[model samples]
Target: MFFHQDASFEQLSIHRVGNKAQDEFYVLSEQPVPFADDEVLPGLLMQYFMSPFAKVNEVYRFMHPNEDLELNEVYHFTKKFFDGKMDFHSLSEQLAKHLYEVSSHPKIKGGELYVVHLKNVQMEGDSQEAIGIFKSENKETYLKVYPEQGGFQLDYEPEAININKLDKGCIIIKNEEEEGYQVLVVDQTNKSQEAIYWKDEFLKIKIRNDEFNQTGNYLKVVKNFVNEKLEESFEMEKADKIDLLNRSMNYFKEKETFDQEEFEEEVLGNPQAISLFKDYKSNFEDDFDAKFEASFDIADKAVKKMESAYKTVLKLDKNFHIYIHGKREYLEKGYDEEKGRNYYKLYFENES
Candidate 1:
């Protein structure tokens, strides 16, 4: 199938390889994609299809929660989608109609959702056409989103609010020539902002995708390396390990790059410890078949994204995440007589 939009809806915009245009998106198939997990697959109302873009490059787009669906749910959603009663476009309209009903935010005058089930889309590169789908909510006007609390809410010349930056959107790219697709999702509503009730409107489901649940594999491995290997190898205590991890982060922040010797000195603060680190780094990488960076450059974006993983935690049986950071003096570990439990007491001053 090709080139479909409601005849009444003239607002459907297409970005493709035209003579005058540099950016382009082409829909190769009018058919719904059969998707998979680990392999890509689509969810209900949200079908899974592959787009050619996934092969050419990996872009960091905020994915929807459901984009990374497991096999069963994927089949369920796709089955509901392709049940043969409603076509892709009809399903899209049904979704759009529901969203319009629930958007009661006085300022957010609602908007239209453009759901085009596409396969094989391409950009300017030499890569072949890819299969995927697009479901984007387009607004007639920008919603007044920002609040007066942050700063002077001054009237300035308006620029087109980036849809992906502010509202809900999703793009799924089919994997290579295969039927599976990778997804990119975006949901930009602020915490304090009044709800648009997209869920109440249609598709009562929370999105779950690998993109949103990214463990930052490399950095995660680094963290595990510290926790599993180095923590035990050096006979370091939990506090020591936490401190070392904190110091390593700072070293990277100040130096902007990680060097083994400096990390040893600043974090371990002893020659013997440094030697142990060196040995472990070498052996661990060799065993894992991964290259240990002599100097690992820390990107600002990565630091921002991965900062929370580095925090020290005292897990208390689902009660709280007692986050501890800073010098050890502020924390006191002791035994509780009545409770028959060991406890970590944190001392702090309320400067405010």
Candidate 2:
């Protein structure tokens, strides 16, 4: 449902229970006798955690409220998400739907309530920074992030959403176009939240000097070229790999910018790129085992070519910077030990 820009907590309280900033208990006894103790509801869990939830591990405790809950539910839910059947978008929708189902239950009446802040907002720690929207229901609670001024009337009043330090309740909402997502810690009492982070299909690369007419086309070409090289179907000239890279760079300069939509169509329409991309994607494996293989292969080749290219093609200094894309575990935050490098690193020229 579309929320009003100025809707108050009182107006939305019917969908939830509990008062703002106060401990509101949801008595499972209100429901049927055999009601299961589903650990704690996600909405309440967020209040306890007080910090925004990032991933499953960060909020996994909610899957099983009590030891009595079957272990099978947790395992199956986790498998469904990690097994590649669901992505973030689909997961979020699923979570919302699940929450709606429970919220709509007869026993759940007026369970969702919020503590609204009019002007001044305060939290225990100074680091909490009453920053953005925070939300939760029965399944999970998370922070809602939006682009700068993308949506949400931040000027009026912002709420503190740090789940790590939350002692009291606070109403958080972003009433604007293109804004409305929640960050909450979920209690996986039986079902786990959906895993949907693997949906990013493209890794964007900036084209310096605005040389390429269609910005995305350069990416498409590079993507296609990479796939072809990976599958070993298309062979590069006998010349050094750096030479091939230089050729691609030069080709990018020659192509003029065209409409993004048209460029996408053209790139996708190309039978060679299409076939190569499909092959590359089909061959790609997101599991831990496949990630190591793919990343290692790319890194080994990219590093070698970079070393040669730094001295010859983009010649300037020995130091070269490089970036790579991989799964979160493959590429750690700040530093990636698996690759023995940081997310972005500087290599010195001619330095061993």
User: Cα-based RMSD of the predictions, in order?
Assistant: 16.6, 19.5
Give one digit per residue, the lDDT tens place, for model 2 in 8-120: 12111112333222433332222111212544543444344333223211101112223332232322232344346744233333322333333322332123322221212
lDDT (0 to 1) per candidate = 0.44, 0.30
lDDT by residue (tens digit), candidate 1, 263-310: 666677778656655676677556643455555565555555667888
TM-score of each: 0.38, 0.24
Candidate 1, residue 218: how far the Cα is off, in Å: 6.6
Model 1 stretches with alpha carbons more than 4 Å out: 1-218, 234-236, 317-320, 336-339
Which candidate ranks first by lDDT, i.e. highest?
1
Q: Largest TM-score belongs to which candidate? A: 1
- lDDT, candidate 1, equals 0.44
